[model samples]
Target: MSDFRSQLQEKLGLSSVDYHSNLSKEALFQEALTYDKGRIREGGPDDEHKAYQTRLGVQGPLVFYTDPSCTGRPVKDTFAAAWPEFEDKIWWKPDFQKYDPEAYLGLRKRVVEHLNAKNARLYVQEVYCGVDPEYAIPVRFVGEYASHALFTHNMFPKDVEGVRDEDEKRWTILNVPSFHCEPERDGSKSERAVILDFKDKVVLICGRADYCGVNKKSMFTVFNYLLPEQQELSMHCSANVGKQNDCAILFGLSGTGKTTLSADPNRRLIGDDEHAWTKDGVFNLEDGCYAKLIDLNKEAEPVIAAALSMPGTLIENVPALPGKPLEETDPQDLDLTDRSITENTRFSYPLSANPNVMPGARGPHPQTIVLLTADAFGVLPPVSILTRREVMYHFVSGFTSKLAGTEVGITEPVAAFSACFGAPFMAHFPSVYAKLLAEKMEAHHTRCILLNTGWSGGPYGTGKRISIKHTRALLDAALRGDFDEGNVEYEKHPIFGLLMPKSCEGVPSEILNPRNTWEDKDAYDRQALKLKEMFHENFAKKGFGAFGIEDVMA
Candidate 1:
């Protein structure tokens, strides 16, 4: 404790500011109830002394709302310092821009000065980003609000052993919701900015954007940058293992069924999001799950729904039931259908809350790799097998429809392509991850397939949603090797160049080939051609061929 202040002063210029270190969840709950700001009218009676009861025993759920301007990730406001040292290493996505190195240095100092002058009470939490001791990075989070600290506690690993030099190489997150940035002076796009200073190993969340995802995804960007250098593949995907010890990985962006499908009653979950594929196998980067809470069906996604009642869970941006006071209403009673708040409403809970999980948050080499896409256009086949190059092609393409109600201002499903399915968080070039994926798939002799869990006969409004019953049937058949070459006959997708099965045992054969189900084959061809054009255009713009991935459509 004696040198703790000096250490902060050395790295962060943080001193004379009182801070608590590694506080437990119980203590943090008390601190949030007392000190955290941005509480809404629905917030329970503003009393910190009372011990509330939850289903897990005794802790009231913590609900928080961010600034109306920052209900979702202020993607445009995010930046990375273009220091000459490592600027070339970053991919610099369309949404994640570069900040001047000189201006970034000045802005960071101003934030520390603001924290000291106000004598703001701070909380520090020490945790690791990944589960593997050999590569997990140690992270130190220093923030004014205990709620953010508790979020740090929920979303990352703690007490990890065998990490190479755990304390020496630290990534510090400077979270200050109170310090506003001046665009002209601080070189920020807005009053709030999430800046990553790779050279100094620092992440600054300045001003009023306190979205909890900012804390998680910022570190995810760091992991994506660091892991690839060691030859590990960092992914935005979900994984689970079946009874025969067969492990499968599903890659997709949010709302594309990665979480929903991977939580199969027949399989044990490895992790829901953010993982690393290394020489040994795959391991989870986070110790918790931050799942979407909008329109969540209790029967379909019982694991996440049941987690709402657990102690120490944080529900963000979900509004209370209509005409009911939040304090008196049970957590379950909060309206899930109401997009009155942001559709990105989320729930943060420790993995311990889940009943079925991989023993060590790690699994063996995947036997099956599934690329999930919600094709609102309804032109793609329901299931198609992929070769190694096809996997690389689609992996880099990362196409899915950005569903309406999932983001602020987005009123309908629009074609969305995020490289590696999460371009914003990928620090290096898309090929860095794609090349590594190809290597891993080859080394393990893995089977790859693309599955579309979107509309069937027509586009979203015109066609019916593909039945989950059928999607599950196809998924189960693939896992059991029913689609192997000898098991089922295959036909080529003329436009996309994918090998899709002609039939499956449980699924209707008509739906197997998407065009057959449509009333007008010509219309289906046009839509299919339009989607293929999208893939080709995105491919040409990115110039992925330079990275050794060729287009299947070509």
Candidate 2:
């Protein structure tokens, strides 16, 4: 064992340790099932292991349950140590809470002590963040739960060429879900905390919340902060390539179809959730894709649905059918409609899960840049071409409608504006990313489009969500150069100034204009005006005055 690993084990009082550093996927899967962290719940009715009950580890193939109180991310309890040099660089806010440097050490000491008290076996997994070795950072996931370590293996690049086994230039995260903190002494907001120290390049913490996403997202936060410094724009988006190597990227927040739209079997997927765009093109930040599993349908999302049955795919918080034997609980049999555990039920698997993925998760410069929005107001057109100014406006505005019950007490479609489509993960100023995107698009002559995968006829309560079939058809048309083929005429929307196409190949000519799709044209006008006002308010609040594209809103 290396000195660093030894010191960490000694510090945490680990009675036994398995250093599964850079293990193959098969070996890691075996260790994960052996460690009793999760179940291998079969996917098909007649697949092997029909007698395998849902007990986990030594117990059986049972589901790992977490406390209901801590289902989602505990942002309030998360913090970043305020080292002197990084204080000015960080965009300090609710999500990026600043912690006292000395106080953080005190917290770490307590965390280490808490781990030592467990006196259990620990698993350590080493992985890489970037697909491009030149920019990739060596990452280590040290945790008490073997499943999370296995997840780390699945979610990040493994077998990176340049990184040696004992290389010390790495970021190490110690994830102990059982460890708790005292707000009074540890300078925390709750028992759960995710603290990042950039100077030391370490993420310390505890998450009894047991939402494994914290483990992946926390590292993404680190990358979001670091990548911009190198002139690479870190984005919360998905990318894919075509037969002619025509690359495209989709940017959106939660509830938007960033993942669903990008998982095109007709095209090669580069990455699903996060990526970094550079001069050489785009490189995936993760080796795997983390897809939401709520109401997942086999026909609508065939690629994602097919991946669920594959070995090594980790399903979190999906409930088994009531009264069914655990052994007979196939993945297909689980109730995706049941969100009693979490609406955030997720599937984590390596890019290998999808047959049509870019090798090393890297692709060439994109020919199209898509900004996906779930506009519940039903005002935005299903598809619209964006100018450079409009692109800047929408990119910074990052507008989307929040679905009811996606969070606590949210029962209606609430308009949300997250700058760059990922404000929480963005570390630098919004302009840093916006400027980079504009420069790249201009340089590459990329076509930009605004796609609304939300409601169409009226607001959420009155109208239905835009059909996935239509959205897919529209996206395919745009990717195949149909939009720019010069046969279609464009008209400007009065409020948003986006150029709406008058006709599309597979879509109805009437639905191309959102106003025509509504029976109540006057009501649509009023709602459009209301949504326009929200956009204006958001632009003013974000201080996009410096961007000089404020006139696009007029």
Candidate 3:
């Protein structure tokens, strides 16, 4: 074992202390959170001696100071239980190592003071996990308002530990320690101590660090927790659910119209990215919407353009000024040059914050499941309705060409398969989610539609990429139930799958067929065969050939 592992084992009281002495910082963080509740409660110091007594009628809001280093291993562990293959890939990777914990804690103190001054109940929780299994420390702070706080720091390697046989395996320890301080009127020592408010019926996840690497994964964890108990609402690439009787789920990968199309002024948004469907109705997971921060122009997406700096919204890694000296200005521009670009985004107001959204909202069973694809090849029709088997086939195929620069070799139509539109965020195996989705769609009579928001004439950079405005127009028409009124015709293709040509008004007629999209017929055939071969190879490796998915592709 390494020195770091030894320190963690000694701190955590692990039985296999010698073996874990060399574990990474992240591993120690996970191991410490595995302690039993009794051990954690018995080992922490008492805060009652320094607790501040508040008057009965005082109107103070509850506040929590999360330990910046206290990694939320419970959440990570839960996700791992769902998809054991992704255990090592979870957690945040923000550049938190460069800054000092003391400095960050000081900033948090100021923020807490600012909030407490507004008559909010304030409490602080300090979180620590054992480096080993033996010594787990959990601390809580209870007082009028705690201004400063501190937490232990650790790091570890990124790797998956094991697979889970059932959903019940998802569990992790929660230990958050915080310092509480209330403002003094006469300059006497303001009461300072640790606080724990277990009765508040809330969980405060705090980190002083700027970013945690698990942006998408963390969002999934939050969604997994927020989902309704009985109903199963899985994540997919889709758009916001609007008010009125209208229900349209925009489906597409990143950079497609999923975000832009759903941000319509005409319709109220249910959620931008993820949502849950129960027997009751659909509920949004995030408190806000997360939009991609790319070459964003005000004219292209106006709603996103306006909500750039809304309060409680987070703007992720963007670039900075090239040569100008650093000066105080709009934080929006500073997003330029931020390295956290993979998850660079903006979260909208939480569903709980909006009164107009569903009251006492729970997950909703999907009424219509829309599968979105950005076919850079411009061969797919604008839209097509799918059968249950087709949905399963496409769900596994998850085909769409990567947009230029969005991926390394994104120009051609790349065969990408992500179960239920999000593989990383899934809590169970791909088949588990698929089976549930198929059963739900059958039970609820949910309709699944494939909408291609990509090019219509030639491959990207050759033929014009589908105009975002036109795509939005098509989406609006579909949501209004205009497409169902028309007699749309679909032709089943071998590799490209189903093609819908008659419904959309603006799309070209010839682009509906993959053969017509390319100038050279033979070359297109060769490339198409290559893509099919790639699909076959992937399917064989994943044990799909036996299931006949390989036969369908061939």
Candidate 4:
């Protein structure tokens, strides 16, 4: 342990610095409770400047807030310092721009100097990113906030072995929420920036990127690039194992019930959010779950709700229950409906919080691959059995929807197509991930399906979101291989040319085909056709069809 500590300090150039490295969760929790302005529940510091005060009698189940203006990810202020040594390997879009390595050097040097000047006590947590010994990489997290260290400790695996050359391959995260950037001086668009430097294997979190997601995702983005180099698939999905040890993987973007549906009481959870599919099997890149908590119904999601009382769990941004102070109220009574802080409220908890979880956060090759989508247009069938080619097509054209009021100007349902269901994090081209997925599917002989948990009768506001009971039933039937045999009747979707089952046990026959549920036949036809064209347009825009992926629907 001492040798590893020395290596970490030397690797991060922190030998002379007074920093705590690889402390226990309990120690970090105490540090955060005192140093990070941790509230008793939601009671913030009176002065805000007294953040450094060590308040005794620290009651836990603590809550913390980011900058009020930037409660969510600062997407605009994110950039990559792609070194000239490796050019064009990373996808450099406008939102994720390329930073000048020279500018980053000056900014980082000054930032470290500033931390030293303030005598800020840094927290370091060294951990692994994945559970699989072959694919997982060691990550040394050096940050200003103790909560970030605890977050990293909660979200990733520790004591992972067989990752050769841990020193050279490991990545470092230099997170300093205290240091705000000057746009002109720091070459940042705003006072804060989240910069990823591939050359140094470091992520710079200047400003209050106290959003715990930045801590987890900064490493995931790197894994997406590194894993594919070894022909492995890094996925943005949720996975779980069943009673008979049957494994299922659910793929989708935000608003899709990947996390919610995977934490089944009957099944054992493997992981939520990030995973890697390798030659051996599938393993969760993260050992913990970072689930959204906006309007969370405790009874409906018992697994997640039950995790609230666990010791290592951390809740972000959810306000205190109405009419009571946090010090007096139970954290489970948190006002999930209150979006006063931000709608993107979250909960970070380790897998131990879940009573039923796959050991080591590892599972076999998935028997069923579910492509989940929340189609706000209500045009997609509840469940569509996909052919192998269709799976390849839809995998790249990863489609979902944005309901009205989700963003600033989206007054109606808007079509959203993310390449591989995760464009921003996919460092390599979409084709890279698509090809790897194809290889895995062929080797494993996996069956794929598209399940819509969005709307039924009509579009959002007019129709209801699909019932969770029905969604779970459909998913259970899929995992059981009910559709594998041709016993259940299926009808061909006219507009999108998908194979929709006519009926299933526990699901209504009328709602199986989305058209029958709608009041107006002509309106349903128009909407379905519009959604079909949107898929084609997305395919063309992404140029996925040219990357050896056929336009199956077209």
The lDDT for every candidate, in the order shown, is 0.85, 0.78, 0.42, 0.81
Candidate 3: deviation at residue 228, Å? 9.7
lDDT of 3 by residue, 1-554 (tens): 12432332233222221122223323332332232011111234433221111111112101111222222222221212212333333322111011122332343344344433444332222222111111111222222212111111111101112323211222111122232333242111222211111112112223221122233334344344334223465565443455554555655666556766665666556666665555555654334444455556657655555555332233333333455322232444544334332334332222333333433223345566778878766556566667787776667666677754545644555556554566545543445555566777899767777777777556676766766656665666556555552456656775656545454566555554656767877766676567667656766655644444333545
Cand. 3 TM to true fold: 0.58
| Alpha-carbon TM-score of each model against the true structure | 0.94, 0.88, 0.58, 0.92
Give the clash total for candidate 2: 8
Model 2 per-residue lDDT tens digits across residues 110-193? 777666665545677878888887778888888766667767878988867864543555788888766667778888888778
Runs in model 1 lying further than 4 Å from the true structure:
1-3, 39-58, 322-324, 403-413
lDDT of 4 at 365: 91
* Per-residue lDDT of candidate 4, residues 402-473 (tens digit): 865755644599899888888888888888888888788889988899999999999997888999899989
After the best TM-score superposition of candidate 4, give how far the Cα of residue 227 lies from its true spot, in angstroms.
0.3
**lDDT per residue as tens, model 1, 434-497:** 9999999999988888999998998887788888888889899988988876898999988788
Candidate 4 TM-score over all chains jointly: 0.92
Worst 10 residues of 3 by lDDT: 149-158
Each prediction's Cα RMSD? 3.4, 5.3, 15.7, 3.4
TM-score of 1: 0.94
Residue 481 in model 2: lDDT: 73
